[model samples]
Target: MGELANCPNCGELFVKGAQTVCQNCFKEEEAKFEIVYDFIKKKKNRTATMNEVSEATEVEKKLIQKWLRQKRIQPGSFPNLTYECERCDTQIYEGRLCLDCAETLQKDLQQTDQPKTLKEREDENKREKVYYNVDKENKWRS
Candidate 1:
């Protein structure tokens, strides 16, 4: 027999490998899951968009996207389960992190002017491109 674990939702005892509630409670969860899955599966639902999923399921958009990327829900099965960024709310189909967030973070990181000696700057300049922050924008300055 497998080790025991407390159900995440109801705190009942279940097998250790289970991450969610036990089988009895899982039925209730499955009902909700079916609602979401059904909503995503239908053609009208396919065009429903992330905002519609948020409104219908009350599940956070980010989490829906995570489920899609993790293959907990098959992409081919439901063609419309795409995730958007929590910050900018941009649609990102591939990964949990959005491209805009990545670009913004990259720009913010590059904006920090690290102090370096002339020789160090020259060596760095030789090895790679140099970026500078001007008017709150990142620009590659030669």
Candidate 2:
């Protein structure tokens, strides 16, 4: 069962599902996306940059950036199409962040999901042993 939600774009109450916005807004976005796609697919504009395409299509830069992140724009065909990395703001052809940022993020994640080995649990259980000499005064009481 879907819950009622106020569309973020139009504030109209809508059944929440895969879409964040209402039907009207979704249709508008689809139309805008088609316009952007048609503009970029033109042979003369195939190699155009994001800003160039945005200016020509008269669409918001963020909307085009969203398409790039969604992988709707192919870098192989449009080599100049690039989006900013979410972390470092570096130009990347795909994904939310660049490769370097992604690696650092992975390293920062704690490995609590990994199970402890038998040797590791045993080491934690062992305590340091101490030896006491009762015959310290008697030098060679072997």
Candidate 3:
């Protein structure tokens, strides 16, 4: 069972499932989203930037940015659509983190994996030494 919590927007008690806001706030956001979506979808507004969309639709820039980050509105179609990277706040068209942050994370993971590779090499060397000793012992016994 989900925990009962006050809506972040309205401060009213609502069974929060897919949305953090109450039903009222959720409906309001939907209306706002539709307005923004409509404005952006128009052929003339296809090249509109984030600021232009927000100004024209009277919708909050952050709200539109949320949609962009969620990929609810694809950057490919919008062309100028962008949102802050979670790590460095660099504007990016797609994904949570920017290319630099992602590359840094990849490098960090590779470094973490290096120790395991070194351990494996050490284990292999030990195995080879053991086999050599065993072969020598067997030859002596023979």
**TM-scores for the candidates:** 0.48, 0.72, 0.73
lDDT of 1 by residue, 1-111 (tens): 567888866889998664445987778656766777777877777767667887898766655665677677776655555766667767666665688788888888887
TM accuracy, model 1 = 0.48
What ordering of candidates by TM-score runs from best to worst? 3, 2, 1
Candidates' lDDT values, in order? 0.71, 0.84, 0.85
Off by over 4 Å in 3: 116-142
Error of 1 at 118 (Å): 24
lDDT value, candidate 1, whole model: 0.71
Q: How are the candidates ranked when ordered by lDDT, highest leading? A: 3, 2, 1
Q: Candidate 2: misplaced stretches above 4 Å? A: 110-142
- For residues 1-142, what per-residue lDDT tens digits would candidate 2 score against the true structure? 7889999888999999977789998899899999988988899999999899889989888878877777777777888888899999999898888999998888766465466899977787674444545585765442
What's the distance in Å from true for residue 19, model 2? 1.9
